[model samples]
Target: MLQRIQTVYMILSILVMGALYMWFPVVEDAAKNVVIDKSEPLVLGLILAPVVLTLISIFNFKKRQHQFVLNRLSIILNFVLLGVFVYRSLKVSGETLVSEKGIGVLLPIISIVFLVLANKAIKRDEDLVKSVDRLR
Candidate 1:
């Protein structure tokens, strides 16, 4: 299954969520305080959701439908995370003094793209299976 393109996509998504976040700065405040990730509870949860879900989805090779479902969920969560990022960037507040934007802010979008590509591969595999079954 590791050889599968979808598996590769899911793995890349995991790296983005788990490893990349550790190194990249998400937002830099005007005071020179760099935030790699938001400390807010809900935001943290949303950030970790795809990491856990993608790991779970990767092992669900036998249950393609369930894997597909998990990817869909991950995609939705990423969208919500994106919205949060937007809100945080636009909000007029003291602590929300985001003077600089970083590449980390776009990680969720990149992850969503990976998830979508994985889902497409999954669907292709499912269709292939169905076609073969019909042949038999």
Candidate 2:
């Protein structure tokens, strides 16, 4: 499991998500104060669900199909998180709610990249195993 490249990618994805959750600010006000972050329940859940899923995928290494499915679900969740951030930043209700978008918004994209790479590696491993089994 740890020897697999996909495992490394999944670990990186987990780290990136952890950083986003702990340190990065989602949005800032005109005064540069953090306006949005994990303090919001929806945002918190969105940010955390992927991390949990990825961890589960990492552990379920023996079941390649299950791992792949989990990663796909994680990717979908990240997209939803990105959509929420975009919507929040774009929402205009007679005031500038999001004065500045922080680096946290991009974290999901990074995580998605890692997850995709991990999925690709997982697929390759699965293919290799299938090919070897055919030799029997």
Q: CA lDDT, every prediction?
A: 0.81, 0.87
RMSD of 2: 2.7
Clashes of each: 0, 0
Extract clashing residue pairs from model 1: none
Off by over 4 Å in 2: 26-35, 92-100
| Candidate that scores best on lDDT | 2
Q: Cα RMSD for candidate 1? A: 3.0
TM-score of model number 1: 0.84
